[model samples]
Target: MMRRFEDARILMYSHDTFGLGHLRRCRTIAHSLVEDYRGLNILIISGATIAGAFDYRARVDFVKIPSVIKLRNGEYTSLEKHIDLHETLKMRQSIIRHTAETFEPDIFIVDKEPMGLRGEVEETLAYLKTRGTTLVLGLREVMDAPHLLDAEWKRNDVMRKIGQYYDRIWVYGPPDFYDPLVGLDVPPAVRSKMDFVGFLQRSVSHDHGDDHRPSGDYILVTTGGGGDGAELIHDVIHAYQQDPTLTHRALMVLGPYMPAKQRRKLVRKGSKIPYIEVIEFDNRMEELIAGAKAVVAMGGYNTYCEILSFDKPALIVPRIVPRQEQLIRAQRAAELGLIDMLLPEESADPLRFAAALKALPSRNPPSVNAKGLRLEGLPNISRIVGDWIDGRGGKEPLRVIKR
Candidate 1:
């Protein structure tokens, strides 16, 4: 843990179970750190199979472990490798432990999962704690509902690990919008270490460069990773199919993880509609979003950030089963006038989607009220990390600022 300020090393763990949120969030943080602090090295340990597809900045790198996906039954399975869940988790556990010991980073930031998948990061957390590493846990603005989150955390013994191993907990969103730990019976001990660092603002550069921009006005529809988004995609496409008189052109990015056959089926369906275009994936999604007349998406953390970053008017169709995190976020944001959302039942009806689509052109942009929301989380995170480097962290609670 002892190191020259200029030589400080940061290691982040992102358990990318089913989506790109964790990896993208960590990458933004890692890039911000190294960019702000000269010679600060950051290494991310991720389970993202598409890790190489991203463009990482200088001084930021990653170690990709075997991937896993969370199933609808609340169990994890190997993403691609033939091994069973137990073997996959064991392999991941070993890789994490070895990386922590060998990397010996001054600051260790664990993304979302306190103990990682199946507690794979337990050994690493324990190891780094004994070494006096500056340990932190990065969280999204909203986890699931309070009762669900409390029960799950309790079952997983998350609070204890948080109390024992982490020096600080950074919630990457504004408290004014949502208090992530509220109603979870977060002990005073853990609460004291919590900081609402505001939302991590994504760069507009990722929105799109000239080359990737769409040639014509279009409504951009995307499901973060496209695995569980089949229903949403289907509804949207069906809406377009049912409403031939729809004026706006739509470009759909079927997430890479969507079953190939399903993607092909969607592609075929889209081919019949002149107004609809379908693609597999785009690393530069922000570009597409930036150029869109309006945005339609699932309510993943990263997607929300991108939508807010561009201040686009968005129609959020969030998933409800398996996890309610996205639905919770979408609902809250809608209530706050940051975006609009269709209920599960409503999104399932093509007629309703068609109705929503027809009104998209007249909808107000999120920027109308997004001005009051905090989007400086990336810079604030860098400041907080700098404070830690200077031994000045934990001196003050990051208060909620009402914008």
Candidate 2:
């Protein structure tokens, strides 16, 4: 199809308080949308401190908001020590509203958090709703444990707000994988708006511009954003140390948010292992994943998508604290034979982890095990956006998938 809608605008929100997962997912979606349509421009509002480290496509850009960090205990505070949390939230809310007012987007896509971090985007959502914008709520394939998720949402009237503001809710996974809103009091009105769009596929950039990208056979170990990744990284290193027979070359990306002391400690330890290579961070993770023989990760949403996108053998060591989202995803994928999983406790057993790591490369890839797997989210989303812009949208009824 020829490029159309030269003046169309899209605004995306990624309340990136904890990890790189949110920003990376939004970036991939934004890039895919622009490629699908000509003359379309997308602006992402991100709270990640390293949002600008990423490369954006021609028509996609981002606005960085004041950073607020979400601690492991589920409390929020300003990333800057001197700034008050309330003050930071106020600034973020103000900037988000101002950007929406100026950008005047035809569509507003909010990632995960309905009201955004601490309801910072509530005003923006309301303003956009008044302007007749197509408001969308994008959710990961799996959310936290249903009970935990329910309590969190119950604290605020999140379900009500989502029903009121969003015209559509896109689950970035297939219907068979998981339902993000399971065990919640979802009204029929809100349930009808859901579209199970499958997983967002990833691809290496056209330019192999990064000289640091790995070459040859190696297991890629990553903790997305490295905020809470120290344990996983340590476990991997311990596995290498425990068994000298595990000689597969490993490249570990410590992630950007990892504390410097822990990063330094891990780097120092991993360096002593002949087959282990540690890099602080790399923005072009897709390229590295593509080059790897297998993958070891904490099973964040973005990494899982990339593992499937690249069809690499994967071992998922999912985090269970603060949120069980990753653990849920890992367990489900394991059940489907898409990937292998180890609890944090299991991974700490160096011998057990080393054995898992050694066996990783030969394990069958996701494509072979999960014939029903899908990675059509990007294209489907593009089509949906086009339909909405081209006068073809109303809540076209879709099956309200249940757990």
Candidate 3:
């Protein structure tokens, strides 16, 4: 039975490792919850350096833990601090547990990471369970390759934790498109609690980036976080350099995590080209996407969501490194005729990239007949949360919109 309370609180954990996807998704949910409920409070625990970049809603604030970044070789390190990995994880664990005990939220949302980084949230989850706080595990639509994910989860015992800790498993995507847990052999009990909330719809805002907004119909190229996007950036620039007559103007947002030396080189090369604009970072990415003719990007979750939401024709060059999540998503989307894809191995050739860029303007967006496509994740999440708070067990049916 749901309780009737005028005021409620939510505490969400986002294990920020590579990009801003986790933090951005949580912030969107936080904003939605605060807007719907009168006296709701949402607290996000994140490690994103750019958490302060966006303007969060009232009653939605974040606690920034010491930032830790994942490197190319699958090792972890503190982003900008002198602290060691062990020390940083310990500190983060302490902060997370302390916040949960003090906040005493009615609901707890864990993003992506099952037990948090290095199992930091286990103790916290145990503590919250004892208090009867509603626990939710939120996952992206598609994780990584089934084999890879299965092994990783097995090592971490994620399946066991899912059964023991989570009250509900919220997959932030429609099941008709892709099931993030498909190959993991999810137990029936946990599967029954899974909610296929539609993809969160991103609002278009011109409130930001007016001064630096690119003029004219240009192709926008971006790599979420730019940590491993240096190759993508170079490829786009090479495409422009190779095909000088390619009339499409290009604007590239090299993510902030891009290496300084590499960024300098990108800027220097772009300076010679009148039609290309290179920026280090911009918080108003949606507005930029809104103004673009088409998109060329890596297949990060947030970027892909924004691309689909805006209905922009996109050519994805997904990474196949530490995780195949992006590559898997891009391949699936391609199969569904949603976006164009250039495999990582194929992206090395300048001519192939140039050809793809030239063809982007004319390629049609995803076919309207695409099945089970749901992009209204924000309002759906709000409604589900509202039901939970109102003690109404009934859920809103998944909203499926044609692509």
Candidate 4:
């Protein structure tokens, strides 16, 4: 068992190289923790290029790691320097370890990846294990399908690592809909450390007033990161072109990482439709989401949480390559009646896309009342982490406070 320390000095590691999911998740959890425990101090370690864009609370701080790019060939390379992929990954891992050692955090919460920054976290995890510091693994509710996850989990030795090092395995999604650890071959002893923490969502106080001139009820098109979103964006544009009566305006936000040539092509195509507006990137995405009548989006974890929290009707087009996590999330959300998902084959069909878009209601459907979704666990996560430091364990009841 990991040794417990008293009080709060927490370090959260989020390896968000391209998109906002990991960073956003860390931020949400940190915000909840600080609000629940006024004495807590949080230091977020993220690799996002746009980390500065977010507004954080007083007790929270950030460390920006060098950015990396996901190439068309499904490979990743460092963006800031011309280094071998192996070398880049090694360098990043070294920095992550150094930061952890120097900071000496009482509790370390690692998001998704077990090894961290290409296994750099292994060094820190080893050091923390020797020092008897608490270590927790934070996982999203849905990872991928059983078979794929089984293969990847074994290959990465994630189960072994979790069983060996982690004191707690906190799942950010409910167990009823999906258990992230299923099929991972976790032993019963290690499984005892698992806790389902419910979905972590950004809480926006009051709707940011809908100021932008409605734009005649247009469909908002967004790909979390346009790296793999080219096909989806093209399909949406084609769908719009095929049906002249579709009548709705189209606002496409090409993610910052999309290739320039591809973006230019989309811009030229969008020009053909007087009602379609193509923007390279916009910081005010939440504003755009709020202004839209319906949303057409990729099924990234962060996007799923936003759609649920905003309570908007959405058509999720998930990416199935590199990882099947998005597809699983979209399918699960659809099954729960939280949102609509377009199958990979149907995503390209103009009629099918249009029909799905047209079928979406303007509001979210009512949800089933359940213990898991009470959002009672958010504050509890904070309390548990704090109490864990103070030598507490097992399940504890959570209290909710309105801000």
Top model by lDDT, which number? 2
> Model 4's lDDT to the true fold?
0.74
Which regions of candidate 3 deviate over 4 angstroms? Answer: 1-5, 206-213, 367-372, 392-403
Tens digits of per-residue lDDT, candidate 3, 1-403, equal 2223476899999988888889988988887777677688899999998888878777899999989898898788887567788999999999999999999988899999989988999999999998888888988988889999999999988898899988888888877778888777888877877888778877664344545456678889999889899898888777778887776888899998888999999899888888788989988788788778899999788888888888889999999988888988999999999999999778778788888889998888654535647686777777667777777333332333212
Total backbone clashes of candidate 2, pairs 3 or more residues apart or in separate chains = 0
Compared with the true structure, all predictions reach lDDT values of 0.84, 0.90, 0.84, 0.74
Candidate 2 has a TM-score of 0.97
Runs with alpha carbons beyond 4 Å of true place in candidate 2: 208-212, 392-403
Give the CA lDDT, 0 to 100, for residue 329 in model 1.
94
Give me the runs in candidate 1 sitting further than 4 Å from their true place. 1-5, 206-210, 392-403
Which candidate do you rate higher for TM-score, 2 or 3? 2
RMSD each, Å: 2.9, 1.8, 3.3, 4.7
lDDT of candidate 1 over 263-314, digit per residue (tens): 8888888888888888889988877888888899998998888888887889
Q: lDDT score, residue 286, model 2?
A: 92
Worst 10 residues of 2 by lDDT: 394-403
Evaluated at residue 122, the lDDT of candidate 3 is 91
lDDT minimum window of 10 residues, candidate 4: 394-403
Error of 3 at 335 (Å): 0.6
The TM-score, computed over Cα atoms with residue i paired to residue i, of candidate 3 is 0.93
- CA displacement after TM-score superposition, residue 291 of candidate 3 (Å): 1.4
Return the TM-score for each candidate structure: 0.94, 0.97, 0.93, 0.87
